[model samples]
Target: MPETTYSSDASGQGTNGSRFNRIAMALFGRQRDKLQDPFYLLLLLGFISQGFFWENTVVPIMLAALWFLLIHLSSRKYAINETTEILFLLLALLISIHFGRTAFMRSLSFGNGLLVLQAMRMLRPLTPREKCLSAGIAIVNIAVGSQMMLEYGFILVLAAALVLILQTFHKLEAESCGFHESKFSPRAKWKEFSFVVLAMIIFFLVFPRYRALSSVTTNLSIGRNAPIAPTLDPASGGMEGTGRLIFQISGDDIGYLKTFTLDTFDGTRWAAGKHASAFKRNLRVEPKPELKYRKAIVKEIALLGGSLPADGYPVALKGNFFQDDYVSWQGSIRVSRYWPADNNIYEYWTDLNKHLDADSRETASCLKHPELSDRAKKMIADTTAAAAGEYNKARALEKHLRDTFTYELGTYDLNRLNPLDDFLFNEKRGHCERFASALVLLFRQMGIPSRIAIGFVPVEKNEIGGFFNIRDTHAHAWVEAYLPDRGWLVFDATPVSDRVLQRPASGFALTMRDWVEFIWYQKIVGFTSNDQVMLYKFTAEGIDVAAEKVSRNSGIMILLTILLLALTGGIVIFRRYSAGKAGRSSSITYSEIFAEHFYRDLLRELASAGIRRVPSETPGEILRRASIKIPSAASEITFITDEFCKIRYGGRKPEEDLHDKVKSSLHAVKSAIKSRKTFATDLH
Candidate 1:
């Protein structure tokens, strides 16, 4: 092999090539095997953050810790074989099955199963493609968490997780390109991240949101479960307190939030009857003359099995977003297809006084009770026998039940043949369902049309925000009896004293927490098409107000002018301060001024000469390509291209004398092209 010596220019070119290669490697290098551990750790943190919204606590934490330890140990040169992978998969499957059964039973939920699979995936060694897929899985976990709970804390956690994931991927890219380990400046990373956050906020505000209906239909089941609808099945277990917050309402008074009404009693279960037709007919009907109507806003804080809650006899319901929501045949207002995930606000015009429609056709189904014992029928007859008017009889029956029966929680047994019989005669102690059911049966026995209204009673009033905080524990069932001439009136047979005593005292802390939750749902999660419209309306209103003030009040106008001037001065000072802190000048420099003029001249000359630059073509590339079309101006064009490249990329300072030279070159190029065109025209 012969040793070859290169000239100075060749040596300089080689140095520049090596430097470019080094920079490229720094940006796109492959990460070391050891770096995988840290990447996995970041992913583990993101996965565990999602668990904060899950129902199960211990399992998610344990799985995350196990996965983290496994990754750490594996990084120390421990080989994971096929047997270990199989065992891990089996363990994940078993855990998912167990958690799914414990949480939702035969219908598996994505909550536990998602976490289990993510952990299992992390357990195995990952390829570059697998790592990207893992990042995607982590994002899905975050998305699920967001769907589960739309809170400020959840948003914060999601943003943090996203930043961590992005940094991890950035590191992976750097490592893959063979770059040595280096620490990225937090300030610079945050500066870049700020733009991403701004873009997301803009998209959230401006993007047109189409309604997405839920695919999963909520199963209405029985037994000590959260109230999802107005219909109650006595065969289901007693209503137990889950202590989960369901929804919040803002109204003048704390009232019952009715979701459904059960009209037919067929021994074991109360269901919707022919009254559904009457209810549906009256869905668009106006309230009775005697009923007082009030406006109420219901904001769903959490998913209560996808059920929409509203006050009794809702005349009108408006969703936060533009979507079709209809009233169920049973008088419950339901979302068209699926239940909304979170932040679904409904504006309802509710009849404050619970009055049933007077025009509704009375059916035998409301009075039919196939399983009612003869003794129970006689007891109901005795209770309302002395009452002359239907109202008096209803009041007497309500008083009798409230005075005699004791109110207690967790008293109903699903196994009993007739739980109502046990509640009325044997046990004599039951929750609102028993009281309501007993009252309804008594009314039916007296030949009065009656039904059970199953829904939430807003008991806790958030004094701070003037909103009612309704929880699952507030679920109650009551009776509604149809009265002649007076329409249907609410008759509560349940003792109120026990429930009042059981109510927790609302403190300042609790009030503030409720206020925060209300704000979170209304301002952030609940923002919709209506909000965007309202925003524009508000801005327009503000402008009109400002104009009016300017026209009417000279003193106020002067103050406004002063304030505007002050604001402008403040902005100027702040920008100057920022530029100084960043070690940059706020004013344009000589090079920038020269570059701007040169660029504009080149564009104007090219446009006049019938030469246009494509969007994708650079200035230097355009100049060289256009030189062939205008040969007479080739030298001027080349000179401009070289000068522009020097000023733009060679870090050379612009000289005052070079500015005139550039202008002369541009003028010469333009004149030469014109002359060539005229000569060609004459020849033709």
Candidate 2:
């Protein structure tokens, strides 16, 4: 039986016999001592997650991580001499070059090229510089991802990568200066980390954001779903679809673009009724839909404020024209002044739910109206009598109207005194307005409070825009009946035209993917100088008011604090520099640099003992192989390798005496090798 002795490599791999074990160890690693293997794992995880989150394919990152892991953990397993080693290096170089070419082309927008560079740099036998380079690559990768990532999950990924990357940089910092530690304490590392993070935040916040780069990159129409925000209330049916593109609305929650509501119908026309509350300018809608709301960035050509077209209930409004905008009690957004007719851009947030649901319905009995003709009254009576519930009555009325009347866009006989009566009995045809108006009247006759809502039914979806496209012709009218506890419930009595197409609401999967997507893009990358100015103005008002109240001495205190911080930072740097001065005698030897020297000497000494070391075998593996011939030196070899690896790769500096201790152990191994050869000669 061959007695085998094992040792650890600085890169965290151990010796294993046979080709399979060698490959396995190299690929997975046996590193329980250092963070290199774990950091690589975390780095690979970031790559995989980002690849999946971004449009980049995960398979390439997967393969790259596998290759890097194999090389990283096994670099010490093979020396520069072997043919296998040569082939591995050659193949790695070719793949890296290929990645460099492809990743550079794709990385600026949304590619995993920097990750490949990071993996390449992390492969074993790393200098402090290479590790720092890899860490920098990680930071760059995160910054790039933030620009394109829409999902909220990216925050978690960023948090993890930030932690791992900081640790990696911290390890490198320790390796660089651990020879004589003056003050690289935990507090100092945290301060450095805080400064790095603070600097990034300052750069992001202080810089005037221009759309030059993001405008081109952000509008990337590649493999993207409808990003903006998720809808809270979605319906199965809407008005007949049309595609003239009156408004290009970007948001997760958009269905019907309601312009205004009409509570008064005079048979001649439906008009907006007076309310107890007048229109008022406000910052945000109180009692907003929990967290579910749409931040719609609307780009409307030839649209302005008599009644601003808002999708759902307007929660908040922001734009040049919207500063003086007033929202009516009936959910009408209107600006007191004229807005630009062309290329008008504005942003607003609206409630996600189209209808407020508190649950439980209340029914109203049919009421007699003297103004309505007998024929009109008869139809309303029949609709109320046949229907059971409030919703069923509405549904029955809808079905009756849809079945009886043909949807015609052309004008009907409106010269008559009672146009509602004429449309129901004689003409039996009109557009959405006529149908909706009659339905509202009929519902009112049934003692149900109802109103006419004017808006464009978003049946026309633009796939290119990933949002509903609203045109002038897509303007629709629908009736909303009041239900107790459950607020206004929408009921469309207009017949569905074949021209009407249904736009599917975003699925749960897509909803999750675009959860915070539009908000993030708009608030971050899509934020313009105008937005910055608005933010600054809003912030400065409070700051200026506070400054007025602040004592003059308080300002001086703040200045002094800044100066004090700078002085402390300077002192820390000076102490760090002074630690390496000539007058000071350090206790640490930095023996890691001499690890290869001792390793090479061991290989030479073993070769002289009639056991030639192979390039394919690492120092640990060579010692194990030689221990079979000279088993007496097995413990001494393991001890020496342990000390060497801990100092070289583990970022643990060696004490002054530790170098002498390793040399003494190496001498014992040489003596054992000499005795083994002598015993072999005596046996011969």
Candidate 3:
């Protein structure tokens, strides 16, 4: 007997040839002695964690040490190739270098080190275990890399690289076994993968996204301004040369447009200054006073992807307004240093001057106080108190403004040092901003506590939602006068003809895409989890939370969750079942079993004629039952027919192994019948 070098057990196939044994012996190489698993484990840990621990050099250095150990261990399995050599050098460079310009860049460098480790493992002669470890490292790298902002181009390249690695390792495995058969052909498999991706997209879109599952708030600093203090030179000349207008405001209330609050005036240009004594985190403006016969003008304001221009005080504002989440307030709205532009929506109704009456004088007076600005105090004192001649003087001043000053956009320029002073005296032709500024200043001159209110007018009617489409062109400004009992009344001086608030005909200002996006944000993406739950309940059983939660604990919520889970489970089970059934072979019918039994007996009766057939075959399968020689055998062949009748038509259970017995008898009958017929023919 040949000497068997390799032994095989019941568990798996064994190689016995001397040459095969030599190949298997190559697995335990000398390099394996120096390698350690901790290096790989550390890499995995760095990939999973975040923050200061990972951001600082501690985690990264630990990961590098781990990589060194794993490489040392891998030496025992496979010899290092040129690729692995380069990877070793790259690791040294990465660990020694520091790239701290950005968090994203730092993460990229760290991820690169992990990739190098994996690539080196793949280049060296790797066993199955080594291959698995490298693959796992690659997976961890991908998982960590997902947290970084990888560009679209890089994502495609990474996907291709992973596929190539998988295919290469699979080929290597097959080559080692001397077998090269692919489990699935590439052509059909890609189509299946595409369908899977499509199904995933559908699932994401339909799944109920629970918002409360994560308490971490999304810190979107897109529009937040940097906290760095800007440098200003007092002697650097006031205006930096006027250029083309950046924005334009036109409306019945577009008077005295204030684009910014500059309280930090350092003797030259007004800058961001300290907050007012009463400034609060979230200031709510008081609604204007309502009076009988007051003319009502609805103003629509838009923030054309820029900052809000207001005096550091807005006590109350109402409209469909969405402030950037990152917008902070050092007493007022502070645009993010990073992202400085955003669009905003504003709309509201204010009590017109027509609401004012003689009896409301005391109410208006009560609203005014002495600690107010000189301009406002003067304006109020001149307008109110009919006992003095100041009331007539205020009326005369108001009439002059209503009859004079032509309305136009861009009447003021960057060259104008005092925009308010220029509009009132030099430039008789001014826009809404100029008109409103003049009115407020005049009221202040009369000793009345009045402030300029900026807004817009003639709000656009959105064709899709029947809501208002307020835009930058609707930016407007007006005067708010405090009344004793009426609070504040909004008064506009700009003529209505100058206003431009409706959608423009050019189609450039308000495009269809913008409208669609607005609808998407307002309806779908903005729907909170609470909204989803309410909607689900409304669709399912017409229940609302307020009516039930106050009453008692309702098991309906629990039952609904369970029912949903069961429905999901049932779908999964049915899909798996259907998939299994699709792979099955030819099905059996009840009639086919009976036919097999009937044919088996006929073949058994022909046994003496040297004819034979299997019991599982049909009647049409037998053709050699013509050589039977005995007369008794011919009678026996007739008996086989009776047996077939009982089993096929009687519906009674056959005897144990009855089909085998019937097949034998049928073969004997065939030989007997054939022998008698063939002998008789020969004699003739």
Q: Report the number of the highest-TM-score candidate.
A: 1
- Model 3 misplaced stretches (Cα beyond 4 Å): 1-97, 102-109, 121-259, 262-331, 335-406, 410-428, 452-684
TM-scores, all models, native as reference: 0.52, 0.40, 0.39
The digit string of per-residue lDDT tens for model 1 on 1-684 reads: 133532224233333456654443343232223334446656666566556444456745875766645554543444566466557656755665655422322133344455555565654566555676677667666655555445476666666776776687666544433223324557767877887788777877786343323334433322234455435666454656667776677756545666667787767777666554232532345444343333233433334433366766677655543244566555666543334444456665666665456444454556776557888887877987898887898899899889987877666474357776777777777677778888888777787888787777877777777777677678778887777777767788888743642467778887798788776766566666656765777889999998887889988879988999999999999998887765344223557567767977887788777788788655655775678888888888877776665555443566668878888998888899889889989999
TM-score ranking of the models: 1, 2, 3
Residue-by-residue lDDT tens digits, candidate 2, 9-68: 665345644555455555555532332443454555545553542345665366545645
Supply candidate 3's per-residue lDDT for 96: 32
lDDT of 3 by residue, 291-388 (tens): 11111111212222233332323333322233431212222233322121112223222223433322232224322322334554454454444544
Worst 10 residues of 3 by lDDT: 291-300
Estimate every model's Cα lDDT from 0 to 1.
0.63, 0.57, 0.42
Runs in model 2 lying further than 4 Å from the true structure: 1-46, 49-124, 177-184, 207-435, 439-453, 456-528, 550-684
Preferred candidate (TM-score higher): 1 or 3: 1
| Segments of candidate 1 deviating more than 4 angstroms | 1-207, 213-239, 245-254, 266-279, 282-307, 316-330, 334-355, 368-389, 396-405, 412-428, 445-447, 460-470, 497-526, 534-684
